[model samples]
Target: MPDLPPIVDLRQSPTALRVQRGVMRFLRAAHGFSCFAEVSLANGRRADVLGIGPKGEIWIVEIKSSLTDYQVDRKWPEYKEFCDRFFFAKPPELDPDIFPPEEGLMVGDGHDAAILRMAPDGPLPPARRRAMLLKLARLGADRVHTLMDPGEPL
Candidate 1:
């Protein structure tokens, strides 16, 4: 058999992970979004950053570290069904104008971030809102439990 190429772990890369951290920090501090990183949705999609606001508003932010990252992703549209608002978060070096005008934009620098455009609200049905809320709560609790007891299974 032909030798296989070495596997690449994009999630562990410094740039991508740093962008996520900065986005998360900005969401939590500035936007009051108590978020869960890498949240799994009902449609078998994983959200990069899913946050729940005080008013139970669901907001999702998809991080794109570079132009290539943004261009390659086609799943972003699917996230809209699961949230009240959607946004794309990227490093300041990226051109925010490339993102869809209908969606929101945020720029990050591995420590802080700013929202360049606000996303329009598309309220979710009560049923979906309830389901998402429950899921977020469960995920958050699971993480806390895992932190408290490293050996525990989630």
Candidate 2:
């Protein structure tokens, strides 16, 4: 392989990883969304999980491994600007009551998961939605390209 930029991994704890996997599986299996992880939005905030549905609807999922993890990460609110709905996913051990009802809630483990609550519809403006779709498409394409051609710059 030729010289390529070193990519920074989005490392998560085993618990966090399990939560993420379950959320991803639930979204794809239940909602038919093509989910992507660590997607950086235009505002410079990276969403832990982002999904685009068949009708171009966007959703962002933030995984919290524990109560402390939830307290530490307050950036989830900013992610709302970029998606039609926002959700928080956590392991079954984490209590769902802690999450705000205004947003969605999901519970899962390593294998599979389910959405406990769905976020209210908050559709993006037409222009913003278009821009976001373009960004997601390009990002998805670039990621696939990197997997295909390892030597390419990310």
Instruction: Write down the lDDT of every candidate, Cα atoms only.
Output: 0.82, 0.86
> Candidate 2 on 20-129: residue-level lDDT in tens?
78888888998899988888889998888899999999999998899999988878899998999999999999889889988899898888888899888899999999
Among these predictions, the greatest TM-score belongs to 2
lDDT at residue 112 of model 2 (Cα atoms): 83
lDDT of 2: 0.86
Q: How well is each residue in 74-153 modelled by candidate 1, as lDDT tens digits?
A: 99999999999999988888888889998988888789888899999999999999999987777777666655666644
Model 1 lDDT on a 0 to 1 scale: 0.82
Models 1 onward score TM values of: 0.89, 0.91
TM-score, candidate number 1: 0.89
How big is the positional error of residue 65 in model 2, measured in Å on the Cα after superposition?
A: 0.7
Worst 10-residue lDDT window for candidate 1 reads 1-10
| Model 2 CA RMSD to the hidden true structure, in angstroms | 2.4
